[model samples]
Target chain A: MNGLKQHYAKIIVWAILLTIPYWFTYIGGYLGLANEIVIYALAAMALNFLLGFTGVLSFGHAAFFGLGAYGTALTIKFLVPSTLVGLAVGVLTATVAGMVIGALIIKRRGVYFAMATIAFGQLFFFIANRWNSVTGGDDGVGNWHRMPINLGFTTIPLFHNSLVYYYFTLLLFALAVGAMGLLLDGPFGRSLMAIRENERRARFLGINIELHVWISFVISTAICGLAGGMLALLDNFVNPRDLRFDLSGVLVVMAVMGGMRSFWGPLLGAAIFQWLREVLSSHTPNWQTYIGIVFVLVVLFFRRGILGFKLSTVKS
Target chain B: MAQLLLFDISNGLITGAFYALMALGLSMILNLSGVINFAHGGFLTLGAYFAYVLQQKIGFFGALLIAPMITALLGLLVERVLIRPLYGRDPLYSLLLTFGLAFILVDGVRIIWGPGSPPYQVPEWLTSPLSSTYFFLTGYRVFMVVLVVTAVAALFYVLNYTKLGLRIRAGTKDLETLSTLGVNTRILRNLNFGLGIYLAGLAGALAAGFLGLSPALGTALLMPSFVAIIIGGLGSLLGTLLGGLLIGVAVGLTTVFYPAASEAVIYVMLGLVLVLRPRGLLGEEGRLH
Candidate 1:
């Protein structure tokens, strides 16, 4: 009975955490601006998989996120007008891109891996920016159709209202978090933790470290892509700026600030970041300085992140 | 054709001189502290901004004298506050920490200075071309080449002859061991980081005359600097100098032949080198952990 109560309590806490976006959307609608915080939160969650669970620190995850956004926009342009299909295509493309890049990059561990990812990401950014004919060259893609969810005979229009899109996003978020949780509880997740702790020992014990890292990279990137597609849909536009190195760097900050070890850390970090952005941008134009200061403090002092520290302390 | 090639080569050499100054500081920091220091580019940006501010208020010469000192002080503060804690941790922590600091610095500049490129004028005294019958070069560019060479030579002298340099070299080999040997490794590490950052600041100030000061220029310069360091091999000043010149020439030649390939050439070179020799051309084998 006590174990069941604990499980219910966990579910309730998650439900409350998930409901925060809905509250923000309702509040944002009344204030007359779209709620962008949710989209960022989703992106942060995707980043958490790599930074939090797996022991890889990426500075170029935004490349995948941006690729996914571009992928969805491209899919919408060429393929049939099914929002689900477009999102799927975006996720698929990002996953493949991540897998291929991961194969080459995962060979170099630690800082080299981080630098290599940044290099490849910059290469993609150049392609996206310079290849203007296809990517619309800096101006970004506009006039793309909003997400349209069709269920058999009835079509659910996703963008007619922000509330509807919020629900849709929330559903997707649930699915992603669920899938990620399942993966973390499985054997692969155990292997990832082992690799993170000691690669040589893991290898000695017969685990293929490279293959596991590559797989994590692929899945994490695909989720990031999905979040990007959703973001493009939310804003009704996509641009090369989405894939900028700064954006990738921001995801890293969010991951670190929220505490990469905790499952819900990214989500909390995203929420706090959104609130911070809104507050700071309103007061001063140079919000990045403030963010930078905070980032330095966190990295220097709060290595475990807030939630991670809290959980650890509680466990103790 | 031969004349044009010679011109390109000379221009490449001049460009390489600036890159060497920038890469040397980065290599020194990495060698001593084991952190990538993403904010190194931000220091360059800060140097340019400081030069711009000083030139407007004081005078061009005064700006040149003061900006690099200010940058070095900032580097010192960063080492003491932000980088000191990561000494015993994995390099990734410092890398991410510095990456965070880079964001803050770049954004801070953007906020204070605004997004648009700040207008800067090259002082009239330094703007003329230096001519030698057959070849003519921008006086400022030649000055840059001379200044960078002098800086590198001075750095070499200091590293080779000074007790401080010996401590830094010894610290890089093993920080704990050095500390146990009663050497003040922390102070040595801070000095190395400060010097590396100061050099970057000087490079930025000089680059402002060549490339023009802008908020986004640092981001663009960062990848090339990294490429130079990677190609030259980490933690070796001589290797970094060679790498910088090689990349500068490669880039200059590519632009001369095929302008489109110029942007991608550094990455391509990196890929080829990584595939052929993963430790980098000058990099020590098994240095990566």
Candidate 2:
């Protein structure tokens, strides 16, 4: 009877998780901002892979997200007719870029590694801003068509409505989360956790510490890229501001608020952040002050994060 | 080629003056307390903003006096409140705490001042051009260089001769030992933090006319300061001075020659330094942590 009850509870949790995006759309239909929240939530989840699992604090993950968005924008403008191909290109580009940077930076640990990543990320921002012909510079890349998935026989239009795109994003997010879950449960995932816990011990135990970190970095960047591509399609435009370090700071704040150690933390954090941003910005221009204050309070008081708190309580 | 080299060297020295001021504060704090004080940049920004506000309300001289004082008080409050609890904890906790404080301070400035750059003109008395056979320099720039040099000299003297300096040096070398020797190490740490913050504020106030006060300026200066700290060798005041000069000149010359690679120049320098001397130019071995 207990086993049956456990199975039912798991099923219910899964059901709720699956229905979240749909619920977002339902809420958006009433409130008129659900689609935006979904996109931000997706980006936040990508950040979760690096911050939550690997204990790597990135201040510039937005660079990968921006690269993905730009990749998609370029693909739509020059190469691919299908949105699917564009997204694939974006993810692939981000993954390769992530791997290259990870290889170089993973040699350093702690604050040095964090600063190095930030420098590289800012370098990308500089390129994005200065390369006017290719990137559209500060004016942003616009005039792109809504992404359509070509099935060869029938073309499924994605940008006809925000609700449809939200569902498509929901499906993609679910797939990404499921893949991450599997990856985290595997031997590689265990290795990453070990490295995070004690790098010297893990190295002594015959783990290739750098390689594990590099792989995690690539996977995290690819996820961010996927979200970036989706965001470009959703917004119908991509700007240099989308790739700025300040946005990356916001992502870090969100990841922390949601609970850096939890799988769904980034998503929950992003949703709450987005909602707060919308509500607060509507009321005052100084919403960032409030956000900063909240961040300080959280850092001061909630060392374990929101989800971490829940887990500790449950364990106790 | 000789002229270019001279220009680079001169530019570097000027830039180094600013960096030395910034890095000295950072080194002092790091030595006295194990915290990196990420809010160093924020305090610098505060100093700049205070000066700008004072200049608007009173004159440049009055603003100069008031800004640094206000900044020092803010520094004391920060040490007393946010930094006190993290003393015995992991260094990472202190780092994160300061980072939080930095975010609040930066955003707070943005909230109060808005996102735009505030106007800060050089005082009329100091705005004239000063010509020399070697180079025609701006009077304001020359004044800035002189001010920085004098301040650094005075600081060196204080650190060398004063009783407070003796306590700071002893406390930095062995805090627990000093406490056992009857020194109030906690009080020393707080005073050291306050002093470091004051220097940062003073630097900011001085930089206001040169760099102009902007919300984004703190971040732009942050990396260079970190580079200076790293290169100068952790906890070595003289080393920071040399490191700042090296980076300033290297960056200035690189920008003049290959603007495209200018941004990467500092990181490249850091990489080379790490490879050749991971302990930094003047840093003692095993002091990296």
Candidate 3:
């Protein structure tokens, strides 16, 4: 019974996600929005890997995200037409940048780290915004779309069919989430939790704090980059705004809203955020105020997060 | 060629002065409160907007004098209501709260002022160049520099000479000791937050004279200020002032030789600073935590 109870949340979450495409539109959402929620959820969850588990506060995850986005978008647009190639290029771009940046700033902890990340993220934004001839600049990369996957056995018609693309994204999300779960259950994840709880004590225990943080930062950036690539694919477009600081803030809010401590919390938070954005943006031009209010309310009242709150109640 | 170099360098210095004003306020709040105050830019935008509204009522001089005080009052209320509870908690919560506050302030400005850049007028006399020989040096530019220099001098005076300043410095170094010594650390923090916002508000009012009043004005300056703080070193005010000016001049120099890389140059300096001297030029070591 105890074992089953632990897995219950996972089962229910997967069940809903697996069937979301079918039922989402009945509730006035479309397949594209479902795709967005999942993509953003992947990015938020990636951020939570560092934020929730590792105890690092990065206010600039958007740099790697945009890197991944531009890498994939540019690869497909300028280098290769293959979807898989674009993704691989995108992930590689973000991973390498992450390694260098993480190495440079891993020693700085807390708000200083956050400040550095924000500044660094803007560096990329400036590049993307100014490199107009190549990046399409403020206009962004249009006139390009995600190509279909050319599997040896059969080509997946991702470009033509929205339903097929949704499943493809879901499959990738599941793989990333699964890998993250396995990592968390290992000794490496334990080390991160220790660092989050008490850095001094963890250092005293001789856990090699900087290496762990640097690795965690790199992994988080790689995942965020993948999400950015997917976002470009989703819109068949990419812009400097995709990697802007505002998106970084939104990702952090999603993590906090869903319960950063819980693995699935960001996905839920992503759904809520996406739904709110869709609904509120249509109703009024001042929707940013409402989103801002949500951030304040969550910070004030729901810091435990929706999932975290439920878990606490269950424990009690 | 020499003339062009001088022109760009001076241009950079002027921009640097603006960045220094903004970064000094941001650095003070970060050092004392451990809150990043992402809404510093929002406060700046609010300050500019406030001056715009007040300018019609009492003219530019009165508007300039009064707007920052109003912005600082708002800052105090924000510290009391939204930020106070998160003091002992992880700095993350306060950071996020301010991040959200920034969004609200920007959007609110948009809703109230409309989404366009409103025409902002400085006194016509101030807009004119001080001399045709030095055509780039407008009276307003010179006036802004003088105001910033005075503000910095005043800030240093308060920090060095006043009771509140002493407490703020002591608190930044060791908050627990200050509080235990019956200093009322809470009031100290609130006042410090106001003082920081007051600078941001003042910068906005001064900037509006040349940059014009736009919702995005604050956001544009926000990044450079962060770079200034980082380059100046994390906990040192004098360093932030120096960092701001250095970057401003760097950008100005870049514009002369390579205009495309002008904005990118400051970031390169930031990266170099982080790699070579992570504590910043004057930042104390072991302040990383």
Say which candidate scores most in TM-score: 3
| Per-residue accuracy of model 2 over A1-316 as CA lDDT, tens digit each | 1457545744764575556555754554331355566667677777777766776666668889988888888898788766888889988878887886776566665554564565567656766776778888789889886676777898666878655676788788778877887898789889888877677799999999878888888898999888888888888889888787667767776777777777666766786788887878789877767776666676677656675544331110
Number of the top-ranking candidate, with lDDT as the measure: 3
CAPRI-style quality class for the chain A–B interface of candidate 3? medium
What tens digits encode model 1's per-residue C-alpha lDDT throughout B1-289? 7666767777777777777777888889888887887888889999989999999898887888799999999999989987887886767668777877887778878878888888877876677765664254667767888888888998988888999988888887778898998988888899999999889889888888888887766667777777787777665678888888898898789767976567678878877777777677788766655
Q: TM-scores of all models?
A: 0.90, 0.85, 0.97
CA deviation > 4 Å runs, candidate 2: A1-33, A78-82, A310-316, B1-13, B27-36, B56-58, B87-100, B114-118, B132-136, B153-185, B230-239, B258-261, B267-289
- Stretches > 4 Å off in candidate 3: A1-3, A309-316
lDDT tens readout by residue for model 1, A235-296? 77898889988788778777767777777667667767777777787898777788777777
Q: Any idea what lDDT model 2 has? A: 0.75
Q: Candidate 2 docking category? A: acceptable
Candidate 1 positional error at A99, Å: 2.4
Question: 1 or 2, which is superior by DockQ?
Answer: 1
Q: For model 1, which pairs clash? A: A52-A260, A292-B104
TM-score of chain A of 1: 0.89
Per-prediction DockQ comes to: 0.44, 0.31, 0.56
